[model samples]
Target chain A: MSEPIAGAPNGEPLSSDRPPAPSPEEAIRPDGRWLAQVEAASGVKAGACYGCKKCSNGCPLSFAMDLHPYQVVRYLQLGQMDKLEGSSTVWICASCQTCLTRCPNQVDLPRLMDWLKEELVRRGQAAPEEKVRLFHQLFLKGVAKRGRVFEGELMAGYMLKTGGAFGPEAIKNARLGLTMLKKGRMKLLPERNKDRRWLKALFREPKGGSHA
Target chain B: MPEVSYYPGCSLEATAKDYAESVEGVCEALDIELRELPDWNCCGASAAHSLDHRAALNLGARNLALAAQGPSPLVVPCALCYNRLASARHELLEGDDLVIDEIKALGGGYAGVEVVELNDYLSSPEVTALAKQRATDLDLSGLKAVCYYGCQGQRPPAVTGKADYENPQGLDRLLGALGVTVMDWPFKTDCCGASHSVPRPDLVFTLVAKLYKRALDQGANCIVTGCQMCQANLDMYQEEIAKQMGKQVYLPVLYFTEVMGLALGIDETPKWLKRHLVSPKGLLEKAQLPRQTWERL
Candidate 1:
């Protein structure tokens, strides 16, 4: 049978990278400013979570995360920004919304995770799951250019940028790619939108008036 | 003929061409005229929401503006696109005036175009009645399927506004009306690791493998889904998952429209089935549905 927990492929224990739990003394001192900032930015009340663990229990990708879903919220509540910033939980989150769906408190954890990812990018912090961030960036770059994603180009860019062109993953998927090409599922050329001026304006940086 | 605006998102142009074709075939058979939204762009998918909030909303708002130019309700096939467009519309109308102003500056406004997920729209009483009327000779009893409604098709009730978000019966009810045995499985609203297939195939493989195993345990021969990404992930990674688990976990993942088209006896059904990574030919043949000729890749 497959590992029930679906351990990390590298054989590293899922909890190995998790930060140690806080002592009772440390837990009592709530980070009021940090909580206020997170709540204000994400519009989610992190304080509402009474450690129900429903979000973590329902999270599909929690097995691969360093900090569980509830832990992310708890860390935010306690002003443990360093642990959250360094955790793989934010990057590993697929934003599937299962956590938010099952949360009795109706806390929008997915929205908070999205905010954390943007914040990390703004602060120039390296994501634990670099490829995930790279994929998102590359995907958006394709959208900004042609107003639609060109699968062939995007795949090529991702492979070359990540140096996974001839990696095991590439070799494994080569047949899948060939089959898609044969079935006309992978287009050879990119489709362009007729009017791209508005799309271009949307991608432009507001403060410096520079193109992204 | 009933008319509605169609937003075939970026995936339909390539990766999900089969879904696009099957959707068109099914819509045509049901006498539904789909008006293609002119010059429609991408919905920015998960990438935009993760990196830039404003951009995600703006991208969705722009599409809504174009969609508003044509019809009252925009029909979106891809669940991810449906979620993005629907969520964006929700934010634009209710959140604030920032996106409204941005769209206005771009020569558009929040026209408040209603966006509906295609499966939900098709399961409506009118469409179901039309399908039932057309499927008089159709017999899909040979196929037993678990309707997988991968996340985003219906979730975050505040956005999609699905009354049965937890246990959506849209696909089950639609397939039941067509004579297919739709199994009541608990994995209906499970996430298929959307977009993580690229960066984290292992994660997707794990999630999809569990889904395949559960479907099999439920005595299902195939899985039917409405989202292109879910269909692709579940179908494409089966062999890999099977190899990893050292077991026979072959389950044909199909688009709901393809099944509907087959039941309705649309000629293009075989053509659509030919494009799937894991062919559902055996199951169909067993059911006495039209035999499909496979294309050697």
Candidate 2:
């Protein structure tokens, strides 16, 4: 495996302004076990990426990412779990499928990012962008309860969980929420799905459930 | 009447209710019967797939299983829901026995049912012809639109099977048939930072601002789309985007179905238009389209 100059947390330069020199001790070494796990979980071979930066070039959210999309694939190829798990890229990726669409190898980077997020939660690691992960969790929790999303409830839960119930952002959202409510765009009541039993069973943890 | 199963997804019921009403009106006028899928659950969208691959598949499969019982093609209006359901179908068709078994265990049968995006379904020759016939008296000549087909509908060509995912022309063709000058622009299939609007409004504002500015640059009066999320993001955030850009960027972002309904002279067209955060009423008035006086309910 080629050594990446390890200065930034993900072994990529912190920014274009500062380029770090290579250090042998800090270089990421390829570990096949993690790579195998990612491939097994995502069903996409990250090793197939030929260092083309097409994924990075096309990603809409790459500008906000610590590591570009191609760099994430490179980390996977090197089995750099710390870099992959630590990335804001995984959280920031909107699953827009831009990278996967332009990828010559059909690398499925978005799917890989999804696996990394699940693995991060599985390992009990806090996502770099805590709110992004929180939003997904709250969204799923609503789905589990009602079998459908209650946007009004979801937003309230999110605000409370993030401790931003009366914060500036929350205030902005609350105003928008009021407008939506007035316009009849927001439902005051949550709609219930008929088969709540099936939904409960589906949300229940493993063993014969859908999660397994 | 040609009948097909419909999946409105969760957004259509609330935030994009306008899209739902417009879709019904347009379909009714076109003589198409939309049989809403029975007891449909959420497709889990990006959240399900992002958190648990199996759960996402199961959620989508459950809906597909229900749709499979009635129709060959399940038409989904929300692009996010469409992507999740179609991705689940793709995985099921890939012959993953584990996934298939889990879906079967969840009482979801895999019958290889087709999941069609609503825009592609509406763009069919028959539907477009019907729309043209219904729109004979409508004058949309003053409306110039840039059809913004946000990412979910046509990306990752492998899953969507859209050969022209990069330069999809379905909305352009449909709008053109309605006599609206569909401006050809490059940002049609771009991402509008969907769902991130909640967690990261800054990102959505930036992306949406770019889309709005590009629409203006292309000489389009408005932006047209099919997905509810796209419409919501593009429509609801224009004020925020304008504030951030420090410019007057008030472009009317519309759902294609609403436009279709307007062309068909559907009575509920004014009601649907009233629901928009950025109203298209002024644009319609400028186009000399007959305006029905509507009092806010």
Fnat for the candidates in order? 0.80, 0.72
Worst 10 residues of 2 chain B by lDDT: B288-297
Instruction: Report the TM-score measured on chain A for model 2.
Output: 0.85
Q: List the TM values for chain B, per candidate.
A: 0.95, 0.95
- Candidate 1 Cα misplacement greater than 4 A, ranges: A1-29, A206-212, B100-102, B105-111, B292-297
Per candidate, the number of residue pairs that clash is 0, 0
Tell me the whole-model lDDT of each prediction, alpha carbons only.
0.86, 0.85
lDDT of 1 by residue, B149-202 (tens): 889988789888888998999899999999999899999988889889998888
Per-residue lDDT tens digits for candidate 1, residues A1-212, read 33435556877445545688988865656666899898998778888999999999989899999899999999899887888878999888988888888898998999999999988888778889999999999999899899998989988898888877787967866777898999879999999889888776778766733222
> What is the TM-score of candidate 1?
0.92
Binned by DockQ into CAPRI classes (incorrect, acceptable, medium, high), candidate 1 is medium
Candidate 1 chain B worst ten-residue window by lDDT: B288-297
* Chain A superposition TM-score, candidate 1: 0.82
Best by lDDT: 1
* Residue B136 alpha-carbon offset, candidate 1, angstroms: 4.6
